[model samples]
Target: MRYSIEEMQDAYDEINRKERPLVAFGGALGGALPAAALYFLFAQIGGIFLPMLLMPAAVIGIFARYTGFPYRLKPRIPIGILAMVFHFAGCWLLQLNPFVYLLGPVCAGVAISVSKVKLSRVQEFAIGRAEIGKLGPNKSIQPTAKASAD
Candidate 1:
């Protein structure tokens, strides 16, 4: 199962080209939808809690799905940042609690961080065109025992 560097690069480029747009659009939608939902939820409920911390992470998860579990961090960074920025912008628009607004960056940071970890785990086990496609641009790759041994 030896892959030449060129082959690896080809796979990376192929995956990136296919994934970048999907991840960007999906991440944007993910961020915007939740922000709007949370805004309305807060407007109706009028309370905030730690569970909100999950929003950005969820946004990142959506973004990661489109990322196709690339082997590098460079691709994941932008999607995470975009999710945060969109989340913050939506919060600002909805006039959410100042505390929630303040938490936007922090939440985004946590989401992005978690995405990195997931990406690493996925890349370790993702091999071959079939596996990569199955992993898809928007799915997370889980590390199998074979990956751990490597």
Candidate 2:
């Protein structure tokens, strides 16, 4: 029932190896679309508040799916950068306050980090269950009946 260190390492490596480029694409698209929408809608919509609130939500939701999926940072960095660039571009096109540029990336970063933590915990739980399965059922404990005196 015992697994060697090498076996555990192999399992960990296998779990980390399943990387997909689609995650980066999805994350980038998630951030860009909302920013584009914000830029186009700013003047016509007549209010900054709604777009501001909705855009980050859209980015976070989109990027959330790809987090904690065993991908390397190389792909993810670009996705975040692309999203930030789009957000900055949107801000530039709208000529909104300068501070808005920092807001989007910061919010996105926090959301992504939180999502990664949550998902990683789920992965850990799954791994624990699998390890438990390898140990088989518990047989050491059995129910015992006490004789009653008549």
In model 1, the runs with Cα more than 4 Å from the true position are 1-27, 63-71, 97-99, 114-150
Off by over 4 Å in 2: 1-14, 21-23, 50-75, 107-111, 114-122, 125-150
Candidate lDDT values, in order: 0.55, 0.53
Lowest summed-lDDT stretch of 10 residues in model 1?
Answer: 117-126
Score candidate 1 by lDDT.
0.55
lDDT of 2 by residue, 20-58 (tens): 546645655665565566568775775687346445445
Q: TM per model?
A: 0.51, 0.51
- Give each prediction's root-mean-square deviation over alpha carbons: 11.0, 11.0
lDDT of 1 by residue, 36-146 (tens): 676567557766565664565565655565444433456556656666776677567666666776666666666556554233222334444435465444433444455
